[model samples]
Target: ADHRVSLPLAALLGAAFLPLADVAARVIDRPAETPVGILVAAAGSPFFILLARRIGRR
Candidate 1:
């Protein structure tokens, strides 16, 4: 889509998400903060690494 069409929709959706992201950021803001998404991503990384190692062993 053209920028004219997309920009308006993006602004509408972004406004809805902005408040939620702000709330999440506030919740996640801690001294030793580990974001939920990041922790999940890190947990996934080990699985991928193990898969790669198993493939290499073949």
Candidate 2:
């Protein structure tokens, strides 16, 4: 197991899932609103960084 490749790949997979979980929460017709943690994690994850960095992060 190569930490160099695997760790980043794991981080990326976790971060990618963060946003889907958020959307699922909001779309599931739950009584309560989505949790703050989910929203924060979705926005703050490296998935967002990966997206923005591709757009130059301006």
Candidate 3:
């Protein structure tokens, strides 16, 4: 397995998620901010599971 593949994937996921977190923090709260890790995990877990399942199938 190319373990190095995960590094770029992780970076890309963070890059994609920060803006979403920032937007949610700005629009969904007036004086508070949501943690980006929560948003990332909420979205990433399902995706990671699906990807793992597909890879396992192969």
Best by lDDT: 3
- Please identify model 2 stretches exceeding 4 Å from their true place: 34-58
Best of the candidates, TM-score:
3
* Candidate 2 least-lDDT 10 residues: 35-44
- What does candidate 1's lDDT look like per residue over 1-58, in tens digits? 5999999997898677656655565577665544556644554589889989999999
Q: Which stretches of candidate 1 lie over 4 Å from their true place?
A: 30-58
Q: How good is model 3 by TM-score?
A: 0.58
* Better by TM-score, candidate 3 or 1: 3
Against the hidden reference, what TM-scores do the models get? 0.41, 0.50, 0.58
Q: On a 0 to 100 scale, what is the lDDT of residue 1 in model 1?
A: 50
What overall lDDT, based on C-alpha atoms, would model 3 receive against the true structure? 0.80
Cα lDDT for residue 8, candidate 2:
100
